[model samples]
Target: MGIPVDVISLYRKACEHDTALSGYYNRNVRVESDDGPVMVRVPSAGAETMDLAIWPEAALLDAIGPHVPSAPRLMHANIDPPFQIQEFVEGALLDDAHPAGAALPDAVLDDIAAFFSQLLAVPVGELPAAPSDWPKDGDTASFAELLLRLVRSIRDRGDQSTARLYRDLGVPEDPCGLLARRVTGLSTRPFRLLHADIHRKNVILGADRTVFLDWELALCGDPVYDLADHLHKMSYLPAEDERITAAWAQVAPPECRAGWEEDLRFYRAYERMKSAVVDTVRWARLIALAAEPQERRAYAVELADKLDAARPCWIPASDTVLTPDDIERAVDRWSATGGTG
Candidate 1:
């Protein structure tokens, strides 16, 4: 869709007010509108340079708004030069009160489970259509294969420098192939909406309600995969993890929870392996974008840390891990190559 003049004016007003809020993929700006305060969310630089999303978030919200009222209300959206104006949510972040690794309060846990149940309750027929290549519901094997294919796509489309950096870090060229073999025997479950990236920052704790943010990463897939993703990213304490798992199972239907316990590890592994690939490319880009020596080094260090965290998932025992010096050299080499990150 073409850009609206009013939208441009709102963006200009945000810039003039210097009200841009920090985010990874978008610059969220707080601006005044006739309706009151609203947030204008515009994509960050090069957001479409990679084909990473399975569905457009605005469309998803438009379809599922009535089903999941806890999500922010989407006021307007545009595809080309993409931007979304949403109701300005007011609340403390879930992380602010219950930091990573900390067990959430009981009330908060129940609230989160309620959110998941409601989200998963959305009728498949009512949601945005999945990608043409997406697997049919309950096809766990095909779902796993599709994820591997996405990682392969990222590797193929990414710069050779990023590929070389992975090799230097001892990440196997075909870890996805290995991962495919290991993730077998997963039980099929009815497909439903999954808020795949539901970590601390994505949740807001309001006075009377808990609001989930960033529907951009939502997918239709195994319900267990959603739980596994949440567990892996949230890093809750072991006891708390068990409680949360039980809570999820209690609320989710039997079809959705079937064989979840056995399959959780495989899904977690997938999350880690994919993170290793995605973070490498992103951190390399950040390093390239850094104008100062220290900033570049900082991003390089973060890249190294991300790889190290995922080492068990993507690196082979036969291969040696990349050292800090190795990471620094790789970053420097990639930066010298001068391609737009």
Candidate 2:
């Protein structure tokens, strides 16, 4: 959590090895460098192409470069380790400056829509098909299964608090059952390019520019899924949502747009339910640290706050504080005591 400043300076000096080198994750000192900042990308190895590829954060800017001149350009890249040298456009983190949860001004939201407009316009045919490992279960029918698999992955890891969170929340089971039982006849749209993880952290704000970063999860399927991701994570007001909704509508056929909105709502819920596994794991990991008891307890409370924020939209579980006893219950449910990751 703490960064060492001297080490940072030394890393900056790494530019010397390959003058073009901006920097790299974990100094291997093997790859040649370049003059300016560079980006490193690592597509998930041994996986199918449809699975999320670890594109450099800089590429997000590159995606918008034709439309926005001030946006960062990705100069170079290394896919093995997966990092990039981006322009590092200076500005406040979007969440800090636009604290209404990325409730940006009209100009800012327009810029975001413009970026997506460009992205959706490009012919996805040019993009390669996902590798063999890309999850075959990516369609609407597979949604519940995918959520279960991810949850099962988490449960298999055996972190008590996380496991407890699922048992307490009833997870994809509860939500998926509701969808199948209530949200009638949901249709599946084949995959399209998606910025599947479009949270505020991935959007960088500048004085005159707002750049989206982190496109590792982009895949050529289910564009609606991406829209839902952005809306769910950022929670922009109806206006922001409407604008983005309209932008995508421009590229989609009228019929596609009509069905898309309804489907997006479902996927949005699916994403939140699935993301809870990750969030609970995050909290459990922090609580397990050897840090002070106060730190652990503090994180436990913070976990509650995160769940609370996630609840009004998704996360139907009670707002109970996560306690060791809760985890023990999950551990019993999982029939394991460790690594329910």
Candidate 3:
């Protein structure tokens, strides 16, 4: 189907009015379409760091929408400028209402579990084309190795200027080596579609339905990793965390949930280790580009928090943990040395 002319028109108008929201990967604008309000999303092209996508998100959404009702309905998509128009979910973000470390309502928990069950049930052939090197279903070890390779690629391409700053912040010389060694012993499990990135911001709580957004980070892998990723990002209360884990296990296929109690720790550690690498590079860029004192300090504080969050996964712990004040001082010293590349 051709991209709707009217939607394109609306998108242009939205852009002109400066209503576009610049997120990490896309610039989104809300516009009214004939069917109802829709969101127009244009890719940020080169501005993403954690995107470990093997398939185009639009194709993934189209293939899974029938099975996963929580996924947003694709209204129209264009490749020339790389934008997609999806049904704009009306309501609030799950984060806005619940926030991190808060307990979720029972209904919301059920909704999350249902989303996972439905997505995992989709046959592999039904989804979009994956990379030729993509791990075969049930190859948990290969999948883990693939993640390591992809993250290593990101690190290699990262700015060399940030290397010194990362060291100063206690980031290990090589963060993923331990994970690579550990994944060798991963037990085999049936693989299926994993949302891969499902934090509160990606969820919309509407009047009638909950919608999951942003499939750019989706991957085919052990379903247990998805649960681990969710737990790490949401920071749900300990009680709620246990409840959600139980709920997920109840609905998940037994084959998919096998050895989850033990495997979950490995995946969680991988997530933390991945964060340390990604956050360091991102923080360097943000710190270097920051224009105002307040903005620079805010980014420094965020860097501190992210580093602290990933501290447990650091293979060899740094000399000392970094506080916000420590980070700010490091940033200043690093900047003075012309380390901002």
Q: Which candidate ranks first by lDDT, i.e. highest? A: 3
Score residue 305 of candidate 2 by CA lDDT.
Answer: 54
lDDT of 1 by residue, 287-320 (tens): 7788898987787777777777667765354445
User: Which tens-of-lDDT digit does each residue in 86-176 have in candidate 3?
Assistant: 8888889999999986778999988988888887789988988778878887999998887788667766664455666777788777667
Clashes of each: 0, 39, 0
The RMSD of every model to the true structure, in order and in angstroms, is 3.2, 7.9, 2.4
lDDT at 214, model 3 = 86
Q: What is the per-residue lDDT of model 2 for residues 1-341, given as tens digits with 9 covering 90 to 100? A: 44444334334454445533111122222232344333333332343122234333445445545644534566545342344444555566577777664457777777777766655655544454556645442364454344445544554554454445556644433434444442445565555556666656556687777776555556555567677778777877878878877777776644345477678777676566555545665565566652686776676665555544445443344445545445434434443445334
Q: Could you tell me which 10 consecutive residues in candidate 2 have the lowest summed lDDT?
A: 21-30
Which of the two, 1 or 3, has more lDDT?
3
Q: In candidate 3, residue 105 scores what lDDT?
A: 93
Off by over 4 Å in 3: 1-3, 284-302, 337-341
Query: Ranking under TM-score, best-scoring first?
Result: 3, 1, 2
What's the TM for model 2?
0.64
C-alpha lDDT of residue 215 in model 3? 85
Please name the candidate that would achieve the greatest TM-score relative to the true structure: 3
Model 1 lowest lDDT segment of ten: 44-53
